[model samples]
Target: MAADAAPRSLSGKVLDVLDAFSADAPELTLSDISRRTGLSLSTTHRIVRELSEWGALERQGRGPYRIGLRLFEVASLAPRGPQLREVALPYLEDLYEATHENVQLAVREGLELVFLERITGRDAVRVLTRVGGRFSLHATGVGLALLAFAPPEVQEQVLSGSLERWTERTITDQGQLRRMLADVRRTGVAISDRQVTMDALSVAAPVVGPDDCVVAALSLVVHADGASPHTLAPAVRTAARGISRALGSPTARRHPAGARRRASGP
Candidate 1:
């Protein structure tokens, strides 16, 4: 069967085929690919052949196909992904060693938080989050921090949308969420208590850019029991500042009091 009058060009069709593969469905058989892409079997096969030949997709042991290693190599060139991860890894490792928890780095892509990196300690709380995965802008601590610093229009959009509830503690009320965002702006951090998951809590801080604008957020998720968001705030803020400094932001200086004391002492 042919597709509807959607005016699908050759390039569009090829992109459609490629878009069929997602994190959930990383590998797909030919029929699965055709069904997911909404293309005919022959069209899917032809485009898949071309993509596979060009090293954009790869076939596995006589069955499914997945995104090729070449795509990953090319994606590594993306400044916001691998480049940011490379710069932030050492600090993230330090944070993990200090807390023995799940450390995450994320950036806003539209209204969603796209996790760029996640470092998990052996005994840390088990989280469903994955690197390169996306989550709601209102659920996670990093998401809240990013959303708090987002443009007014973006804030309005999120507020107007359906605030999906993930747990009993999830803040779905627009007014409450707004106030929480205000607090994040004032405190330079965000704390999510059992919001995304019942057993987890997260603390997050904003990462500023050269323009002193919040470009991303860094966070630590740990078990809720006996954990205090206030205690974790300083560590999250420190890591965020480190990443901001690496990003060439002048506002990335040490804590204000420490800087003042150092200047006064010398």
Candidate 2:
């Protein structure tokens, strides 16, 4: 006789319902969630009601349910999210002031990177990134920096996996990507020219934690046509170091001898 499958845990079912909502579909009817999660309507209803009662979901007069403010409040407490943002914001602001471009802060989560904060000027080039959005760790400047400093196993997994190409300039070959990561490690910066979008370019640097381990990446995205990535790299690196210092990184506290030369140019 075939053994019966183990029953799914209630918490697992709850998480499935939550996962059904996303940036593309921020609101969903109970039936919508049921279909997405492959749960029966009745089971979904019960889970939804419990989540609603717990302030994880909110609905208005039989309308579709949306993620609740309470959930945001809970997510705010995560060290990688708001805490990192709090430490990085002032330096991010300084970078934004200096360049008036799109300044972004992101941290790696597995093979993906999540945006924590962004500051864009009124006339800055358009970018596809959104706060709280997840992006693959092989195409963006921030992603490249994070990947370069990532553990060897993580780097191998990304190198071996399918790399989604968003634009013609996106590097899909593993060998080329491996070389690019090496450059990022050697220079302390990553330049992604027209990788995500043809009209945009980004320069990024890694931000380390108190243990001198890279905990996040900081970047500046600008229009590709007239901008010089080499000119922008030092400023981006400097601001990233500032954020790392604020986060208590010992490496950031000790300035390298040639940092001023790099920041000021030849």
Candidate 3:
């Protein structure tokens, strides 16, 4: 227990403290940071003060601690991270204007789906998703789309076991999920009906890069009542294609109707 309580190195301690903040718990107290990092209060406070001084964490007037702008300034330099968001924002705007629904963009990281962007209307069905949040790859439209085109090893690894069930409609059966992925590959789109939430439905399509590899996905979320997945697919796919074009994908403009490529899109 004593061994487990100690970080192996100074770098590990710094990293553990930095990771204590999350989308769900953006602001944390010193005690919260201590518990999250499994470090003693004195150690946690010492590092927290150092990090705060360096602008990696922020504290205001005895307020809870939150991640600081300096991290964002550094993170902005990542090529495919926020830079991709800048390219996709205009297409996302167009999709939102056309449908007035919840539009989202996401990328696959391991077996988790990380939301990159989201645009929601006043009446969009309520969702638990937030930008920079992560969810499983078997319970969302963007998840299915990215999973469908993911490397075979990643597919097999996720399918092997531990498929989580988010809602009653979420697919936990490996065989069934395999077939759904096949359908996504066949149609160039993915539909998630009440998979994440019973009141919402999502339609998604992939955005491929110039190398003909899928890089991200785009989707639209609407009320499930009287909703049509096929009806929404075209617009969602169109937005995905547009974002791909803005990212300089050669196949974006050249994609044929019902393209047979892995990432046919719109």
Candidate 4:
């Protein structure tokens, strides 16, 4: 007979409850939480009561419960999330003012990329991403930029794994993706032309931290009809470099004297 499995700890059970909430299912009843977390109704009720009391979950008129603002409060303390966004917002705003397109900032989390922020004009081409949402690392321009500078082992894992296709233009073949990542590194830019949606394209560049390692990616998503990734590359790269400098990246800070003037614009 197989050995019995180890029992889950109280903290693990609590994590299971929190993990039950996601973008698709933002609200859930006690019974729903119990079912999703594989916890007994009594346990679920006890935990939910405690979490609600502690402000981690909030109920709506005896109906389903949703994630609470307390969670966002705690998440704001994360150096890589809110802090990074705070540092990059100015440069991002400048990019927005220049192009009036969909501007996005993202960071790689394991094999996935999580959006930290997005700025879009009312008339900008509609995009499917939302701040704090997670996406695969092989589809979006920001994802590609993050993936290109990822550690070799991380790169190998993504290249060896199955790539998801969001649209007909999404790259799925391992060899092709490998080549694409190489190009992103060589050119210091990544382009996703209708990869996520048939009507949108994005041009992205890497943002590095003080360690001189990429910490995030910045991108501009626009309507594909008249989009030119080349035309947008210079501005995107310049903004990314500015963000890196603001973050104190040594590589960005050490540019030769006149390089800064040239990088400003033509």
The alpha-carbon deviation from the true structure for residue 238 of candidate 1, after best TM-score superposition, in angstroms, is 0.6
User: Per-residue lDDT tens digits of candidate 3, residues 1-266?
Assistant: 22277445767888888888887799999999998888889988999999999999998989999999999999887656788888899989989999999999899999888898889899889877888888888889999999999999999998886988877999999999999999999998999999888999999999987787999999999999999999888888888888887777888767643354566544
What residue pairs are clashing in model 1? none
Best-to-worst ranking by lDDT = 2, 4, 1, 3
Backbone clashes under 3 angstroms, per model: 0, 0, 0, 0
In candidate 3, stretches whose alpha carbon ends up further than 4 angstroms from where it belongs are 1-7, 256-266
- Give the alpha carbon lDDT tens digit for every residue of 67-93 in model 1: 998888888998888888888898899
* Candidate 1 lDDT score relative to the true structure: 0.88
Instruction: Name the runs in model 1 displaced over 4 angstroms.
Output: 253-266
lDDT of 2 by residue, 156-230 (tens): 999999999999999999999999999999999999999999999999999999999999999999999998999
**Could you tell which candidate, 1 or 3, scores higher by TM-score?**
1
Clashing pairs in 3: none
- Candidates in order: C-alpha RMSD to true structure: 2.4, 3.6, 3.3, 3.3
Whichever of 1 and 2 has more lDDT, that candidate is 2
Global lDDT of model 3: 0.88
> lDDT of each structure?
0.88, 0.92, 0.88, 0.91
Measure candidate 3: CA RMSD.
3.3
